[model samples]
Target: MTFRPLLALLMALSVTVTASAQSAADLGASKPRKESTLPLLPTASEADAALISAHLLTRFHYDAQPLDDAMSQKIYTLYFKLLDGEKVFFTQQDMAKFAQDKDKFGNAIWNKDLSAPFDVFNQYVLRAIDRMNYARGLLKQGFDFNTNDTYNVDRKNADWPKDQAELNDLWRKRTMNDWLRLKLAGKSDDEIRKTLDKRYAGYIDRVKQLDSEDAFQTFMTAYANSTDPHTDYLGPREAENFDIQMKLSLEGIGAVLQARDDYTQIRELVPAGPASKSGKVHVGDLVLGVGQGATGPIVDVVGWRLDDVVNLIRGKKDTTVRLEIVPADQGQDGKHEMISLVRQKVAIEEQAAKKKVIEVTDGGVTRKIGVIELPMFYSDFGARSEGDKNFKSATRDVAKLLGELKAEGVQGVVMDLRNNGGGSLYEANELTGLFIDQGPVVQVRDARGQVQVQGDDDPGMAWSGPLAVLVNRGTASASEIFSAAIQDYSRGLVIGTPTFGKGTVQTLIDLDRFASDPTTKPNYGALKMTVQEFFRINGGSTQLRGVTPDISYPNNGDEKDFGESTYDNALPWTQIAPADYKPVADMKAYLTQLDQLHDARGAKSPAWQLMLDELAQYKKLSDRTTISLNFAQRETERKQLDALQADFRARHKAIDGADSAQADADAQLDDGLNPSERSLKTELKEQADAKKAPDPQLQETAHILFDAVGLINANPKLAAEVLPYGGKQGNSASMAAVAGATPLPTQNSAGQSGGASRAPAAASSSGH
Candidate 1:
């Protein structure tokens, strides 16, 4: 049951990551062969699933096995489609070879050993190629169907795909109609080839015309991404260039490209990536053409698939490769617009993190709030603790950031975790420790329900002050861990809609590790199995339900659309006994009032109003089955929406003259009154005023912490020896926030750390 180190699985099946040696025979036909000559391959249905499962684990970095062939089939087919066909590229000859082979390789490959012929391995190899080719072609010719590239990652770290019908069509029609168009255009085969060449020049500026590339990549990305959230299969050299692998040490235009529908489109333009350095390319640019050297006619590659297109763009570093692009959001009728860009080596420094400071007027005082965006929770797991390593750990960096923010006299801090696609688990635990005093932040229960509690090693909190943690739906896995802990401990006010659940843990299990003999399949693909589930200390599982709303915000993610919580047969929500513990403070009595206040202001606030309208629209389009088939009506609806948005944006932008009303508020301030603040000028003023209450969300959190502190103060005996200063924390029962006045981390002027505290505060639970 135990697969040694899953590290190989982690590094296995990486895109553009070529295997040691894959001979033509290895990638060739899979026909009947004598099984007794070597090791026996799994032939039984059950055995097939196990073998396939093993392969999946090896590739996807999963730690579990499939129960049957059906399960393996579902996973394999789904993954194949997700991968935008498959990784191995083959030509028509390859397909024909497999088709003609009949059954020469081995019985295991065939579904029917006793009947005609069914070598799935060989058949799929060819089919996968066709699929990839088709996917590529579709990207070139713009898609004609409505496609949705959606994934669901819930709190438990599980993911599933949505919009299957359109997705399937996107895959199927990717290659068809191309040669037919050339034939119908009455162009000779040679003539068509020549046209293809001249059209290549048209791509220099249109390289950003990534319409096709984006679709295919998005379509297939779910395959690789669906795996352990890592271990992608890079189809061509273009994929490798975009991977940003420092270890490989290749240099080229710093642009990431993917096959969306037909063309190779840019996924992101690294800030200093050669493409960006040229000042000609931008993220979301669609590449329609390319030019190899200095200056010439741009290649007009309007309908080429990604592989062929990428092959044309590939070149050495410092070589001036011209690119063509249609900037994002600039297409009208999807016309072939063009702009040119040069290629250059992408600098690594540009990919590093950046920080910003925002000031929000609270309680009539302008306080600086620091914002740090983490793209990935990356940390060099290989060279840590045991080696002399200068590793980049999100936790360590964040701890340092807290110090800097505190020194800047920032009263409240907001940890922006939006779009943080997750990284190391150790880093997640360590990051949570920076805010919490440190304990078992999360529990990892394996497939058999064996739980391993992950705790913090650090005793010092980087910052303990009024804090706000911001999240959107994209926050997942390890991300969910930190957020879940904060909520369970009532550490911070959870804002935004529900997060991407994705709480399930996956471990890559390589079959090569279990092979009794090495002669069989030396190295098979990996499997990304769901091996463990994460649970919060409060007993609530951060599984399919994900993190619930504390203070909801209008965000770009569809709350009900994406995230693991929306998947079928996902793990259910459950909880274990609450671990014996205490938090910084409680805000029960405060939450009620705060919620009421938020409800009131939220109704009046334009932001919330707009969000409500958006949510209503979302409700209407909750399911495609429910949508009208009337195309005319849909167009009319689109027009109406465009007009509505235009008006809102216009009015909001012109709020200047419309809001000479601010003059009234300024006049009130001149009369010894402040009107710009969301709440009262002071505690005294708040107590006196019947109106102008603080936001319910903020008030609720503050009041909870305030009351929790008071409760502890009133029952000083409860904190007696542990009140002001406590000894080292022992078990869960005695666990409390690190005690001391290292500036009670607070998100408010009153110094209430969002989730961490100077001392363990009283605990209060409320329902409703």
Candidate 2:
């Protein structure tokens, strides 16, 4: 209830502002001409918005860093990186020209002078057009992949081309690499040539479409992000999209998309959405083409804008949309697969918290453990305000599930917060209340250096048994709060990898509200600024260094490639005075024994070994920045990669005793089924898939929990100390305290912004 007013303030602030596969040869035959246009310039309104945003960020942002000449240089560098990050478009001469005004960016932004940024962007557009045109020409020359020449794939740190000739040579090698990838995928030389030609044409067309708003947004975003990664300037269209994402209801295939290089990549799938139900889509997968209906032509989509690609995938309810995607693990081998899905409104119920039971046996004794897979910290604010007693919320639903698990006589529980990008801050507080007695859950520090302790005032424990909180790199914001609270209280064993370090809290500011001219007509976009940072009850902040699990699993991803630490301007982790609360029990004493058992079991698990091997292979592949252009060499490498993948699959099948082919068949929906029957089939398929691939990390967590249960049972004193209400688990007095309490007031849907990991311009969810 303490957070309700803050939530209300945020809601009030928000109220103001608001495909196709083309076949290679036939599809690419015609060249799409680029429209000649004047240089894009910032409009009067955008300039005003930029000035207003600069004022707010400098005066109110949590970082509290002054925007002077030094800050100007940061914005300048960030702008160039965003414009031509790959270093394939601009030359060293272009950089030299841009460097002349590098120290003037801050002053220009403050003074509302937009000419410098616009001029730089115009130059970038021209360079991009020239590069694409040169690339198109190379397609006709036909590549000779027999040479041992290599192409560098990672050019972020590479030097810019010194001249036009050097730039041309870079394009030549890039064109050859593209051809080699398609050739490896079994496409003929003619098809590859046509595809490359069309791709470059699209690239040029996209560049030609850039307008004043796009330029303004990019420049302003660079200015904002220089303060902090989470801070951003959202244009009108983008502000609307952010609202939709928060609502979590869309009319597309239910996938969150982000642009990476020339491809639109799947960031995450909405639960129970068409894409997730189809089971063919996955995170990190690159979408290549989109088609309408089952038989529509698959239009080439490479080099298209993120929003354009999203529009292509979204359609009316029940309409079929097809996608051609390169699997995430395939890594530019050029292999692709087509998947068809029906468009529908993503159901909120599908994204709600769900429960299942996994049985863990150790020393011939089996223990039933409840696993609650929470996708996000969600709540229906609208339903709650209307006095709907059963309004949905993470804490409410999880409470009911805990009662059910209790009835089933489970011994322990594993809270699976993996990939939960975070949501409602109120729900996070109440959810922590479910596991611990009344106490501070997290501390919030404002830009003014004022600290506020947010905690659950509610008096009962939902579950007092041995518990383990499972997390990964995707867990962030509110998720980090709950995990850190549990760890601080020693109420549960935090398992899995370090979380996504997003401790900063952001709020949307309507720029139009602050404009001095009333006649401006509200076209000024909003600024999402960081106003606060989160600290755990133990006084440590979860900013750049997320909660490190008490027991860490082997991580497969590079820490540098993911999480808040990836941002150069991210706020540093800090601390505050520790909150006054007693930990249920110190988990450190039992960690050594538990770890020994875990390592021993993993040593004997073929699946675990396989995961390690795959991680090693991934590391090896990730380290390579160049690829040989020799056709024979590339063919042999491709064969070796294929053989390795085949071996991994075969070993996995042997371990799980599930045929991959059969699993695929089970996932497909039969066209003859009625609507109700189709729904039933989908549900059955989801269950079958879950059974087919049991989560190794989760299974291991369950084992760890069982081990904790055993340890507690062996030590009566420890058991007594661990139990809630002084050895009385879920006592009648605690239950009565909660039963008579007033219902929690509903908070605004935008109380705490989620997923600080991405900039608004880069991420989008398709549909309304």
Candidate 2: deviation at residue 601, Å?
0.4
The lDDT per prediction is 0.44, 0.72
What are the per-residue Cα lDDT tens digits for candidate 2 across 1-768?
000111122122211111111111222312221243668777788888988888898888888778899999999888877777778887888788779999998778778889999998888778878888988887887978778799998886899899778888888998888888778878787977877786677567667756676678778878887887778888865665554445444466877676554667776677788888888998768888888788988888776655556656756677788899999888656699999988886645556789998887778988778899888876655455676565556776787777677666677889999988777666777788788766888888888899988786655566767789999998888899999999999888999999888887777677889878777665688887778887899999888888999999988767767788887777787888999888876777678889998999899988788778878988888878898989999889888887777677767678766575345344432222212222323544656675666468998998898887787767866665554544464544222222222222212112211221211221111110
Candidate 1 wrongly placed segments (more than 4 Å): 1-253, 257-353, 383-389, 509-525, 554-559, 618-639, 655-768
Q: Alpha carbon lDDT of residue 61, candidate 2? A: 85
Per-residue lDDT tens digits for candidate 1, residues 478-514, read: 7778888877666665665677766666543443455
Clashes of each: 135, 8
Number of the top candidate by lDDT?
Answer: 2
List candidate 2 stretches off by more than 4 Å.
1-37, 250-351, 362-364, 379-392, 407-409, 517-521, 661-694, 713-715, 729-768
**How far does residue 406 in candidate 1 sit from its true spot (Å)?**
2.5
